[model samples]
Structures are given as C-alpha cells and as structure tokens.
Target: MSSFLIICKSIHLGNTLKIANEMAKILECKVLEPEKVEAEDIEEAEVIGLGSGIYYGRHHTSIFKLLDKYSFKGKRVFVFYTSAFRKVKFLNGCEDKLLNKLRKHGAEIIGVFQCRGESRLLGGVCKGRPDERDLARAREFAEKLKKKFS
Candidate 1:
C-alpha cells in the first residue's frame, strides 16, 4: 500500500485542519501539524498533501518553512486550502504560492482543492464553513487522487 502524508498549518480557527482531517480520513493517511513533521516523514511519503488556511493572501509561514526544510523531488503532491472568501480572486494567490514552491522542488502536482472558511477578520464570512458540504468535497477529492495515483 502507498503511504500518504498530510501536513497542515492551522494557526487560528482550525479550518485548515478540519479539511486536512477529512482528507486523511478518506485516504486512510496520517495528518500532522507542520511543527510535528520531520524530514523522514516527508522522505517516507509517496503522496503528500499540503494544506493551510489562507492568511494575508498566503499560506501560514510555518507551511513555507516546512517546505523550505525538506526536498520533495520526485514525490507526488496535492494541495488544499481553506480561505475566507468564496471568490477565487480573493484567495490572494495562496494556491499559486504553495504550488510554485512545490514545483520548484520537482514535485509532481496532482491536484488542488480550495474551499470557503469562516473568517475572523472584519466580522466573518462563510461562517461555519469547512462544513459538511466542504468536507464531503474534500473527501471526494481525496478519493479521486487516490485512484489517479494508485
């Protein structure tokens, strides 16, 4: 069986962790916070999922640090993110930023998923998000990834 690793940075409300957990459950993989992940963890993973909540239009710094600390060359990678806005334009390039970094490491990009998340800034938008619908979508995405990479 192929091994999967999901590393996520959920600094605030945990929306990113919620989505990561859903994917992990469907993929039957392990989910770890960025701080808990090590070089060996990345080395052992066949397929890696990187996730985070959009913060100031980018993934949390911790996620970037994790990427910087390890090399993902030749690994298959997928990315998922939770953000405050539903409009893709409002995402502030979070997906692209992560994707580019992964690409720079020569990782094969397999899939990307993004969904609205409740925001604490300026009141809240998409309240109660990473809701059932979002989670279901995340799980479905995971299933497709599994099939494609299996």
Candidate 2:
C-alpha cells in the first residue's frame, strides 16, 4: 500500500484544515499540521498533499518553511487551497510558489484543487464556504489523485 501525507497550515478558523481533513478521509491518509511533520514524514510519503488557507495572497509562511525544511525528491505531490475567492486566478501566486518549490525538490505534481473559504479578515469574505459542495469537489479530486498515484 502507498502512504500518503497531508500537511496543512490552518488559521484560527481552521478552514484549510477542514478541507485537508476531507481529503484525508477520502484518501484514507494521515493529516498533520506543518509544525508536527518532520523530514522523515516527508521522505516516507509516496504521495504528498500540501494545503493551506491564503494569507496575504499566499499560503501561510509556515507551509513554505516546512517545504524548505524537507527534501521531497521523486515524490508525487498534490496541492489544495481555500481562499476568499473561488477563481483560480486569485490563488495563482500561492499555487505557483508551491509548485515551484515542489519542482525544485524534484517532485512531480499530479493535481491541484481550490475552493472558496470563509475569511474573517477584511470584514469577512466567502462566508459559509468550503461547504458541502466544495468538500464534495475535494473528495472527487482525492479519488482521482488516488487513482493516479496509488
């Protein structure tokens, strides 16, 4: 059986964690906060999923630091994110940064998923998001990823 790891950085609201948890359930994988994951965990994962909520137009700095701390050569990677906007363009910068880092570490990216998430910042945006529909989409993405990598 292939091992999968989902590393996520979530803020106080836990919107990103919610999405990560949904994927974890679908993939039957383990999920951990970035701070809790170690280099060995990254090295051991055959397929890695990195997820976060957008913070200042990018993934939380913690996720970037985690990636910097580990080397993921020859791993299959997937990225998922929740943000105030539904359009991929709004999250492109964050997605690109993660993609570049994974590529730099010689990882192959197999999929990407994005969805709207409630944010309290700026007086709130995307209220009630990552809802049932969004989670369903995430589950579908996970199923596809499992077929591709597992």
Candidate 3:
C-alpha cells in the first residue's frame, strides 16, 4: 500500500492527469483512475487526491460517484481540477460542489491545485495552458503536501 494515492479522471485533454502525474512524482504515489481504485488502496493511503476536468461547472460524474462508493471520513484529501479559466475566483465555483462533498464526508482538505486547461470548445479556448508554469506550480503543491505529511 502506498502512503499516497491520487484518484484522477482526465477525460478531456489529459490536463488533470498531467497535474496528477506531477503530484505523484513528488509524493512517490500512483495515479489511478476512479474505476481502478480498490478499497484497500483508499484505506492505506495517507492522503488522497480527487480530481478531474470541470464539466458543466463541476468535476466529472465519475469522481462524485467514486465518493459515493467509498467514505473519506477522517481521511486527508486534496482536490485538484483544470478548466478553461485560470483565475482563482473563477475556479472557486468549479471546485465548490466537490469540496462540499468532501466536507460532508468529514475529509480533511489539505490543499487545492488548479490551472487552465485547453478546453476543446469554443475552438479550443485556453490552448497551451497547463504549460510549463502550471506544471511547476503543480509540482510545488505536491512537494508541500509531501513535506506536510512526511
């Protein structure tokens, strides 16, 4: 069992998966999609990351459903997401529902990471986002998490 586990869904342009991989590198953990996560994986992880592309103002349905099947009570969690917008203000609402669900389940939110993703809509708005700068920030966030839990 790894000390850290990140359950990620990167259905759009693999944006969320990129961030997940960055964090996984720092934390030395595995990035598993929601469907592939087993009960023991969640149980043994010191921290869990739930993330996906923002769809219709929230995370993918699969992420929410993953929470439905498992409990995060008393567990530490970090939420990450990517969308067409990069500003924190705009990203706030994107994570609200997902964070609210985590709160309701008594999960301790350790941190949040967000960045602009090339939305393959409106003729690919935000293209080239989650570029080098965003990836560096993601690495930094994961390093912080590793130090906090180390």
Top-lDDT candidate index: 3
Candidate 3 — which residues are off by over 4 angstroms?
A: 87-92
Give the residue spans of candidate 2 off by over 4 A.
88-92
| lDDT of each residue in 29-130, candidate 2, tens digit only | 899988999888887899999989987777888888986788878888888889886555654566888788889988889888888899887688888987
Candidate 1, residue 115: Cα displacement in angstroms equals 0.3
Per-model RMSD to reference: 1.4, 1.6, 1.9
On TM-score, the stronger of 1 and 2 is 1
User: Lowest-scoring 10 consecutive residues by lDDT in candidate 2?
Assistant: 85-94
14-91: candidate 3 lDDT, tens digit per residue: 999999999999999999999998999989997999999988788999999988899899889999999987556564
Model 1 CA deviation exceeding 4 Å by range: none
Q: 2 or 3, which is superior by TM-score?
A: 3
- What lDDT score belongs to each candidate, Candidate 1 first? 0.88, 0.86, 0.89
Between candidates 1 and 2, the one scoring higher on lDDT is 1
Q: Rank the candidates by lDDT, best first.
A: 3, 1, 2
Q: What's the residue-level lDDT of 135 in candidate 1?
A: 91
Please write out the lDDT profile of model 1 over residues 26-144, one tens digit for every residue: 88899998899988999999999998888878888888898788898999999889988764655476788888988998999999899999887869788899799999999899999
